[model samples]
Target chain A: MALNIKPLSDRVVIEPAAAETKTASGIYIPETAKEKPQKGTVVAVGKGNKDHDMTVKVGDEVLYGKYAGTELKLEGKDYLIMREDDILAIV
Target chain B: MALNIKPLSDRVVIEPAAAETKTASGIYIPETAKEKPQKGTVVAVGKGNKDHDMTVKVGDEVLYGKYAGTELKLEGKDYLIMREDDILAIV
Candidate 1:
């Protein structure tokens, strides 16, 4: 069951564990040997904050840490619960 | 030459590119085919913001994204320039 979660106040909703299978060198990494990329697909994004301006949006692919944001599981899929500040880059 | 940077106001200095090399299945991945983990080590930590309380410090292993934070290089080592908020978990 996919959740229709709306992030509040500079927070972003991310689908975790969706990582690229290859490195920049074009090597094929098996799932059993792949490192967790600090990457995700933006499912939902929150409004900008009063202090810092928000620059990302939904559907934007992003990079972040494995242990950076709070982890939540909805319908068996892992998702990240993080503030906008925790977001590192938009790809 | 490593930089002794003092982050200002809730920013965190992270040494990027240091990630776990194996998946849960314990497969051996070569560096040539590893995905970028959104994980890093806290090199320097900033003081808490006036609004949100700061909870992490230097030397803490943290996770973030490849595209989540700003990137910087010092003496060829890639580092991440991010706010404290970008840090997701403390490992």
Candidate 2:
């Protein structure tokens, strides 16, 4: 988590949760059938934009859209960069 | 455009601009070659969320991400519904 990543106004950096490998019934789900993870922990937050304030903070668990954010890799880890508005809820 | 559609909570309704059919050099680009339009006019907007205030308004021209928003059809016209945060800049 020490890759020195910073987001701009109204943007955030997140560490995505791992996708589920098994179903509730204990049935194994193949890697190709697993859904993309939609939850993550906030790693960094930017200052509020011209009109939007920074309400979400680092360490907060958040839910975002399935297609929200841009994916990137740093230090062999995955990260997502998205505007705060892309977040659906603070879990 | 009177489809009676309304957005809720930081969402907005937009009418996408038509895709370009011609290149800048006066070459006619086939329908399959045109890029999706990323600009649109706001038709309606929702109230801001608890932590975010609505800064965009109806009739405002906006720039958005290429893949942003959900597309829907109403009254035989196409529309896009997206969170206000998806809007990049007011044009």
Candidate 3:
């Protein structure tokens, strides 16, 4: 999907993985038990600032801090915008 | 005081302002009521990485987030080490 907004500085736009609704054993999980997913696909990246280089590219799956990033919606889909440093690693 | 350690990769060593121990009226404040100081002096700064430049200089007074940085002790003094981005502004 094309992104309408571009993040400035060292920020990136990510498409977070959908929250799990059930356990692998088929047990239903409650909303309160659902933790934010730390994994996402890089959708858009910024031109890095002078001190750092952009390490992850579009389409890279990455893990980030559980509480990292700002939440936003684009075309009714949830997305996260955060600095690349918030991403812990590329998976 | 001299800092024996040098920060790396956009990190900075800051000497945090002492926490307020009493109210303006001279009433003693409880430990739980004392909030972390958001101000500090830049003691050391890392060389800017490829993407960004060092905006602050040594001895510059700056404001940072209350919970920002890692705590450490050197020569019986407290210090915080954090990324320059964590500093909100130079005052």
Q: What is the DockQ of each candidate?
A: 0.03, 0.02, 0.04
Task: Please name the candidate that would achieve the greatest DockQ relative to the true structure.
Answer: 3
CA lDDT for candidate 2:
0.71
Model 1 chain B: lowest-lDDT 10 consecutive positions: B24-33
Taking all chains together, each candidate's TM-score versus the true structure is 0.44, 0.46, 0.44
Real interface contacts reproduced by model 2, as a fraction: 0.00
Could you arrange the candidates by lDDT from highest to lowest? Answer: 3, 2, 1
Q: How would you class the docking of model 2? A: incorrect
lDDT tens readout by residue for model 3, A1-91? 5554545557788998666644344534235435777777898886677667899999887778878986644455677778899999876
Q: Cα miss at A24, model 3 (Å)?
A: 59
lDDT by residue for model 2 (B1-91), tens: 4448779898999998676532222322224324677657789889978866787778876556677899989788899999987875454
In terms of docking quality, how is candidate 3 classified?
Answer: incorrect
Candidate 2 per-residue lDDT, tens place, A1-91, comes to 3335446558887888777634334533235534678777898786766678988989987778878986644344677778899998876
DockQ of 1: 0.03
lDDT of 1 by residue, A1-91 (tens): 2245545446777875444554344534235434655767777675555676778877777767556766644344567768777877775
What candidate 3 gets wrong by more than 4 Å, as runs, is: A1-91, B21-33
Which lDDT values do the candidates have, in the order given? Answer: 0.62, 0.71, 0.71
Model 2 chain B: weakest 10-residue lDDT segment is B21-30
- TM-score (chain B only), all candidates: 0.72, 0.79, 0.80
